[model samples]
Target: MENSRRSSLKLFFFVIIFILLAPQALSESDECAAEANNSCNNKARALKLKIIAIVSILMTSMIGVCLPLVTQSVPALSPERSLFVIVKAFASGIILATGFMHVLPDSFDMLSSACLKDNPWHKFPFTGFVAMLSAIVTLAIDSMATSLYAKKQSPGTSGHVVPEGDREMGVEVVSGGENNNFQFHGHHHGSVAVGKDDGSKLLRKRVIAMVLELGIIVHSVVIGLGLGASNNTCTIKGLVAALCFHQMFEGMGLGGCILQAEYKLVKKVVMAFFFSVTTPFGIALGIALSTTYRENSPRALITVGLLNASSAGLLIYMALVDLLAADFMGSKMQGSIKLQIKSLAAVLLGAGGMSLMAKWA
Candidate 1:
């Protein structure tokens, strides 16, 4: 176990080092002009649009994220319901497409921009390489964190994590001492069985919430900065609307995970607050840095591209393995064919809707 833990840490560090240095290896100096001016370059109008975007995005994000949390008050939205399963599947699909169709492509575009160094940046695929490495690193963190948290929860207690086979076969095994195993069948006095099932699962959900939020925030800030620094009133007007919708959908995805974590009210409020303000804060920062910051500059392209790639990898992995796979393979979906079909349709709709938004965003 010690060897395995050490190996995981080593692999994690290696990936981090590679991610940091990959840009250097791929760096080249290629000068290209910034985007051509198409919109009225009025400082006062641009400032007004930025302020409007900041307010609009903040409100929409709060509404989208808070929607899921508030739904917990309604019995119909309970986690056990088929409707809940379908809704979550749809949210997961939105997250998946955001990673693949939105962020990953953005990273590719930035890294492959003509403003960057040509010899390495143009010759090699740094975006995919970083994204691939980022995915591996994310998986390592997920597994290791889960194992560590589980161990902490059961400190010095020696017992198997009730086998999956036993759980599925309607048997709940409670081990208190060596050779002392109690098996309970069905829901007869189900308190112990339910506790055993929920214990470890809760920890996993909390981790997913925290990591998913980080990934989403990275993308949010990058896009916000791009929008905030723009002098194009025409472009900003359209983008403000598109971005409001973008944050709303993305918030719904993050909000679903946060809701599942079953956090205390204070923690939920804090998370929601942070998600809602991140874009606005990014915009504010961009406004402050607009004079010196250029999005198409070599440094900007490399930094944002790498960050986007890393976020893409993290989001994709969490949506696929943690959110989508866990639910799709769980007992709820497995027991109902109709629910599965409905859930699949929801997934496609969610994905399609997000993909369509990407065209403008």
Candidate 2:
């Protein structure tokens, strides 16, 4: 089941990448026509800064992502502890602010740019529309994936072997006959009892981790491209600082999810590598196509704007519904009022930090 989900996710990413790049490919021949005035005084200085940025951002991203993974051995950061919950809450907040404060506004700006024809651009709220549709699509995919996983885990349902949940639940049922059915009756007594099932929760976490990476990478590539194709030294300087912090904070969010997924050592390394390199990869692509890539061109604006809107929707839904809501309403938070307050504060801090960074980025 997990294998199938991963395959589908890969295909989904490929499709999105194609959609984003198709316009760039078509507009290459006419890039000079759509090019905005270059305001930078020193091309050499800008190139130096871009090189510095590439290295700095890459290192920061690696450190941020690997931090959580390496610290998983710490007792305080254990998955069941209160600290983990609080930290995850903060990460969720970062992701939430990323969608609302960063990507969404960028989409609005690009879509509303004066460079594009005023007719359709001003005729309707395409940013909001695309974002809304993306949210709905994310919800549908989330729920369907969960349902499918559960079904696949069922015994004798599809000729696939039953996983741990079914076998454990079955054992309890048969063992009940020998006893006075107390164990079986007690199992379903609480509202959140069923959610404690290890297999189901693990499955959910893995799904969330994979999906969150997809949403994040979409924006990461876009931002990289934006920075890479720009020749303005003044703009690139501020962008370098902003994106470094941006990638670091976003890395923490993704790292938290990856930790919760309980991936194997090899899988963890692979995921971390992917997250760390994506933006740099985008920067590289941007540099290679710098001459032919017009950032303000109509084709570039529309394609990137739509992709941002879609990614914003996906990230917002996943952060709010899957990450925040799920954990807040889970057994752990529900059992403690004080802890919930701390977690909420952590969330605000994370969101506030990201929101501040948005001003420059």
Candidate 3:
């Protein structure tokens, strides 16, 4: 158990060490220091901007995450509507673009940075290697968790009870939604109570939701930390804008997952709070460490690089395999040709928007 916990958590030590050991690497020449001093002429303005950034990002993140949760209060927004599937597809695209356009490229840049040793860094693609390994690791954990959950679930609790209306119609309405399409192989029989086995599917959604949040948290912290530690006000403005949008859309995607997880009220609130505050919290941590945190150091580069790679892999896999593929290839999507076309367009729009934002970041 101890070993397993350590294995699961070993990656976090990279960020911790990056934060703590960064001071020792402050060996930049006088020229570099001189440039930084020249550029940071308006400390007062930068401080105010950073403060605004914190408040702005926090509010936006809260709004984005809570937006989806608020739907539960409204009785009209059923998942059976095409709007729900389209929204989910759009959010999934944003997540996919974040991994491919933002995190993966950042990894490549940091790992292949000019500051690193060319002998190994240039000779091999460590970013790709680490990302691939992380993706495989995530898959292993996903499969293992599913099996374990399946075993522990009692037979009495093996499925959800069909609603009276659904029973009369010989169908389970709740299970037909794109987000709730937990059936395997995209197979569904019309007028059949497929959601009778929703207990196991709910377990799977819970696992995927938690896992998705894990990846998002790691990536958000890294981005926030770098932004907080930056001394350049000119670039900070653009990064802040990009990140605000980034966190908002990512929150929406995560919020959708939380909705599907069907947690208790307290659990739902707790999860939403964490997601809302993660990037801002990372920014605060970075602000506290700014004096000692040298973003360009070799050690910092390697650690952030590997961390980003791992995050990229996890996000990419979850976005594509668990979220996108599960929903797109599900019976819900397959049953509606018009919905599929609309959803594909939504995916492209979301991905395209995120990709455009990457240019600014």
Whose TM-score is greatest here? 2
| lDDT of each residue in 106-203, candidate 1, tens digit only | 99999998877788999999999998998899888888977876676454446334422334446544555564343657655553333445656877
TM-score: model 1 vs. ground truth? 0.82
Worst lDDT 10-window in candidate 2: 174-183
Question: Each model's RMSD to truth, in Å?
Answer: 7.0, 5.4, 7.4
lDDT of 2 by residue, 156-198 (tens): 3332223332333432322223231212233455322222255
Task: Compute the lDDT for candidate 2.
Answer: 0.78
Model 1 lDDT, residue 340, Cα: 88
Q: Work out the TM-score per prediction.
A: 0.82, 0.84, 0.81
Clashing pairs in 3: none
Local lDDT at 20 for model 3 = 67
Residue 89 of model 2, lDDT score: 91
Off by over 4 Å in 1: 1-32, 159-175, 178-195
Q: 23 in model 1: Cα distance from truth in Å?
A: 17
* Model 3 per-residue lDDT tens digits across residues 272-345: 77677767867777677677667767767777888899999999999999998988898999998998999999
